[model samples]
Target: MLFHFMSPLALSNSYFLAFRPREEKSQPRLSTPRFSSQRTLFLTENNQKKLPFFQARHHWMEDYKYLFKVVLVGNAGVGKTCLVRKFTQGIFPPGQSATIGVDFMIKTVKVGNDKIKLQIWDTAGQERFRSITQSYYRSAHAIVLVYDVSCQPSFDCLPEWLGEIESYANRRVLKILVGNKVDKGDEREVPERIGRDFSDVNHFDYFLETSALDATNVDQLFEQVATRLTNDMKITDERVHQYRADATNSSSNQGGPIKLIDRAQTQLNSCCSRQ
Candidate 1:
């Protein structure tokens, strides 16, 4: 099934060659590699970095050490898809169509030495898709609530979104309030101070303004998501480790059946002496 789906793109050149007639001199074929062109550095024991040319292969499969689910919920036209596209593909999708139900994308980023994969779910903001989108809230590690800076109604409807999040999401889920399209300076409706106040009063974990069009703080936004979640997960893991260690120490210190027998014998001896 997987091969069937991938065969078209894999055999496209062969299909084109079969249709063309044989010629005396065939033009040189130009092939473009699918992977990134960036060079990977491999350090040696001498602390020297090895840079090899034409090293297009990536070690992403082995480097991906963590996976996190992040969901975006906001009004329909608030640029959620555009933000995800800009972050994942580095392109501003002008005139992007409204999302129907839900869309998802995966992008890997480095948080310290650990490679963190962010599974971003872009939920449709339409009223009809509320049922479908709400189902995703419970499984998300972080929920980003986005609003348009130029739309007052979008900002005003934040309470409704928050209510839905509270009802459907986990209690410990990280919540972030994002004011998007901040580049529209003249047409801005929600002031940054007001947005901050709203986020503070509502207990959002963090707040920021971003522009998917200008690529302003777009990278920072996702980086913050990955960093915050990575730190939080690390802290949680440490606490669990400490708890397990404490539990083990406690169990080892507690006397087993032998101590219970010794206590019972001591009580019998005391009764016999009193008699």
Candidate 2:
């Protein structure tokens, strides 16, 4: 599995909470909820009102640095839905059923100091939805191919998934290999080494073994996706800026002599006409 060898970076940012759980009992019960056009007002014991953390910066909530579309594709019953729910909503759904067509969700996470909005597309694994799911790959910035560690058939189907991704997704798209259900240790079918080897041979960007049921590496999985994509985009933006700067500089440098020549030519014409 690929391990992040860089120095630790600030990856997660928690929202400011209005009240701490421990302080809730000591404070007087909130009463007569008041509202303002710009803030949410809640009255205190002395009749003074205060704004909640979120209410203070409600407009800033919509601001983000970038938006990336991440699509999850894997065989049926590989806990793809569970992974998305756990990462976005912090829930491991019980008795989860196979997806029908495709489910879409939006989540904003902080990477370093920039806010990134991820448009997660959880595609169904059934054959009927193959056409629909394939349509999503072309636009995806990242594609996470998941498999069940306890199911050999799911692990075996990875090559087929890779083929589809290569045919439909962007060539530079971030490809991640995930072995789900590591919590199923006793019933494990695919070895970790084998999965890692597959990921390496197939030139996947990253690989990890995650257990969505237990919330193992769930946050890390998505965090890596956000961080990697953000870094790539920043690099691209820098290159574009540099290219524009270079072009502008070249045009300005070339214009100096050309303008001088034009002015000299105009002066010569005036002199000749005067003579």
Candidate 3:
């Protein structure tokens, strides 16, 4: 699962690690730690305890706080492959062939001391693969819709892609629009303003212009995805924690159901006041 691919800028390697999807049947539970004379534990930013640095390698594989599935979709030859390659492998695949059905990669990134594992799916853009790609949308935590800046047809077909996304993706999935091939300077057909405008009109969570060839804004694109998803998940975790606390307190007062509504209303009011 390791390959050496050469780009004009440098020689780099891309790794396609063999990944097994984490089981969803049971959630991982953190238990109170028991101190041992032979072992030491360190606290993460979120106060999760872990093995000390020297013995953490084995634990690191499962150390992530969250796992996000990020799928890239757009028309064929739009450089979706290149963008993923550049960010994960630091290589601009020269004359890269169109992705067949799907290319998958795994990368672990840190968002403010929390480890986030990104499961990246680089999907084919050909019409023939449309059915297959749509299946991935529903389970994705985020979707990146890419277009080539030099290709007008690719830009024009965005609506078709958006339609497919709307039909298949989760309603709350993070949506990102990326305009690739910014290296095609003079040949650019899609202006930055036009891309931003489309993103706004279509309610994209974020928009970015990137040049996989030169690595412009390439890393930033995926970093933003991780940061946004992590933040959103943290907020959700907080609400769940609040609900549990309220339920526990309610049982003591025999006001279980009513307290839940009151807690939710208080949270809503607090959010509105902040806004």
Candidate 4:
């Protein structure tokens, strides 16, 4: 008998969501709702091919309604990676390592009738990687600032993080504040009320406390991101439509002679039809 075991981190990275909107159904649906299973072969340290079990929805090469970039930023060891792993893979990475410069993963979710492909960028929280991380802020549609509830220093650094966000991120980017590790009741140094107040005072669009280890609010957090972005995009598209309509009306009105001739032709056609 042969036995093989995989670590949590390896398992988390092995599978990723590749959701495609169903062609036949009016509503978006995944082929494997529970867990889309996919297999990948990789060369092991011993130069032998190994297959790891992972769950993700397999989709065709091209199909998506919208693509969004979501970036995560906070101090080191703030459970940013763990939060992402928990949300993306439904696993708590006990031995998660700090991100180097940056890392990314793709997860497709259905927001209303729109199939949104979220490109989640997990940046290194270390000061040395500040330059690298700051560059990603401008392109992100949503920015999630994460802090550990049990760590006072992390909470205290929110202002500094906000400063960086203001300096680097888009002026209209959706900002969210997340206090992670709320499961640590006795270890918690920052109260929920304080976190909420800070978020309100700092003008965050929304605030929530989460525990990646226990999978509390992890799914809700990402869902909120997708929902908010989808709504915002819809509003923007409506505004653009209104602007175009106004522009077309203005252009038509400016065609004074052409409009009069067209109106005369319209009246002549109506007269002929009446006859």
Candidate 5:
């Protein structure tokens, strides 16, 4: 039921052990305390509890919290959706349809001992969706800017896309410039040299030519983002999600819910250029 947001960009492994408050029914007076790591969710007499953040179970709702907001953007046909789809679902969404105004999805991945929740937002690449969609960029811990390796126009639009993310989205957004559609190597219009040069001079976190079609290096891109967020200053939800409202109406113009994966179905889901 997992959806790969874009084939080139990955949402990597995250491990979260939630600590919750549970009371033991069996009462026994003992000088020493008991420790069991076997229990997936646990509680202690002390004021602490643990739960797995990604798994939505009855006990976890009261314990775990959202960790990070991960956002993705690019031109309409640049494979943004494909890259995510491939990484999350392991299979791309079949066929293609423009992501309406916006799309929301979340996947929890592990970073070392702690599990970090990744809130993924995939927006419409079309220019018309810009106003309605740019709002997703704010509060994003990481912003993935994508472009098609085979298309000139999409590649040319990198700066404007980067600027939009910078000005409107999270000002401190971590960026990865993706040169997608590397499978179309023969058809490439933007040379790797140019893409590499721009990424280097701009000091982008990372850049690579990837093929969502082949599922290449998609996961690596996200791993880098996760590492940055975990190692850098850890920002909390209040400062980031203060503006995002979930209690409001479903169809409101503002950002809303995370689309949970339905077990029955799935899709195949890249991009490049930065300046």
Candidate 6:
């Protein structure tokens, strides 16, 4: 029950409490109350007071650098480092040492009302460091599987990267397929259809052909990822309104969804009726 009490008190906005027994054999005692907000509040139920443990993460934003973790994975020499260098440090410097394990960088991108600070992990694309680099995949919210547009072997190996991620990465991770180094048609080996097929079968969020050497669609790609991630974090008004409506509807039908009773009064009534 929602009560506008004159005094300040803690409340569960639109939730109910459930009891779960502790499995420990030590104490001879009792069950603890667990808060569940799966149900809606009812206006008819009276004498309801707030029980602790209804916690919700509030929406707030600071610098976009701390909100999300994104990972980059693909074959060796697929321009993963070049793409990152172009975006974060500016200019894809040549003759640099290949990634030893995983390199990290930060970029803040705006998405609707929030700014998401993306912590991008560019994993080593070589076969040797797979063990070392694979651990980073577990924490990523989004994954970009890169393939060189000019290399069929790199494109063909895309499935292996995808398979690894499915086996061990974040279960809810969003994925995107990227074809890098599009500027070099002289060396181009993979066709556009290859990228499309990978995107379709794996349910990629988006696909783009980019030239990290020239900096193409690099910003747009990350922006889209940042936007999608921010959306995933939010509890929107639409969902809130729909949940309220569903609960209200459920409460009004036939027998009230769950018959709630005040424990003290229920015991008293049982005794009197028996007598």
- What overall lDDT goes with each candidate model? 0.69, 0.70, 0.71, 0.69, 0.59, 0.62
Worst 10 residues of 4 by lDDT: 1-10
Per-residue lDDT tens digits for candidate 2, residues 113-144, read: 98887767788899888987887776577899
TM-score of each: 0.71, 0.72, 0.74, 0.72, 0.63, 0.64
| Candidate 6 lDDT over residue span 1-275, tens digit each | 11121111122211111111234242122223111222221112211433222321111122232246677899888888888878876787787666767766666566775555666778788888888767666656688999999889998898899999888775557788999999998998988887888799888888988887788898888888777665544323234335445656767885477433354233222111111
Which 10-residue window of candidate 6 scores lowest in summed lDDT?
A: 11-20
Query: 30-85 in candidate 4: lDDT tens per residue?
Result: 23212112232111211242323221222321346555668899999999988888
Kindly report which residue stretches of model 6 are placed more than 4 angstroms away from their true locations once superposed. 1-61, 235-275
Report the Cα lDDT for residue 101, model 1. Answer: 80
RMSD each, Å: 18.7, 17.1, 10.9, 13.4, 16.6, 17.5
Best-to-worst TM-score order: 3, 2, 4, 1, 6, 5
In terms of lDDT, the best-performing candidate is 3
User: How many Å off is the CA of 151 in candidate 5?
Assistant: 0.7
- The TM-score of predicted model 2 comes to 0.72
lDDT of 4 at 213: 94
What is the number of residue pairs that collide in model 4? 1
For candidate 3, give the lDDT. 0.71
Candidate 1 Cα lDDT to native: 0.69
The TM-score, computed over Cα atoms with residue i paired to residue i, of candidate 1 is 0.71
Candidate 5 wrong stretches, greater than 4 Å: 1-66, 234-275
Worst 10 residues of 2 by lDDT: 11-20
